[model samples]
Target: MNMNKREKIYLIAIIVLLGLLLAKSFYLDEYKPVTEDEILFREYVEKVIDDKFHGFFSRSKLIGYRIVSIKKVEDEGVSVIEVKSENEGEYKNAEIDGKYVAKIRKYLFHVLPYGEDKILSRK
Candidate 1:
């Protein structure tokens, strides 16, 4: 069979597309935003903390919440918020972290001094 220029172009396009799909299975290139509920959860975490965050958590229930650390890792497309809660279940989110990671929702995450690490810092 004789192939024309158009036929060659079509064949190249198909091969390129297939190559992309295969590469995708092996690697991730981007991150999609968290859902609305995830955004709300982040805000809720803004509320949960301990005395280390007293300057802000003092007046509100956000106090006494200590987030020793947070490490952001990506899986598929969602962000896994790894937090060490000073107190058990201080920062609980049943729907989000319930399956992907265990013990992730146990601590207070907003322990940083509110309004600023020192003074004049932004929250």
Candidate 2:
């Protein structure tokens, strides 16, 4: 292999860039031991999401709606939890396979979902 100053710099830059990207991804997907609060929060979110699919003539028609992933973000002085959910069921004889993103406010006693549910897919 022939060594050149410019080639060495470029190679080093590429390696550093790749290392940074790998670190960022691992940080973003960091895993932590599940706590009681996390479990409770997930359950609460599930109930809230399932209720959204209810209709006037239907009584708890939604089933298998689950919190697929959760991410926490801080804005201003408040902590907002972003939840991604996968829902599957039959609503009024229509097959539903849906994905949703819900923003929730973290509170002392309970977490409340705010804003409209962002539908990622419904088909």
Say which candidate scores most in lDDT.
2
Predicted candidate 1 versus true structure: per-residue lDDT over 53-109, tens digit per residue: 457434565533322223233333433342335687555433343212111212123
What count of clashes does model 1 give? 6
In TM-score terms, which candidate is top? 2
Cα lDDT of candidate 1 equals 0.38
Score each candidate by Cα lDDT.
Answer: 0.38, 0.40
Q: Which stretches of candidate 1 lie over 4 Å from their true place?
A: 29-123
Per-residue accuracy of model 2 over 1-123 as CA lDDT, tens digit each: 997999999999999987775564345322232654354345445555656655532343322232435433222232223334454542211112223233432211112222233322211
Q: What TM-score against the true fold does each predicted structure earn?
A: 0.26, 0.30
Cα deviation at 117, candidate 1, in Å, is 40
Q: RMSD to the native, candidate 1?
A: 17.8
What is candidate 2's CA lDDT for residue 20?
76
Q: Return the clash pairs for model 2, or none.
A: none
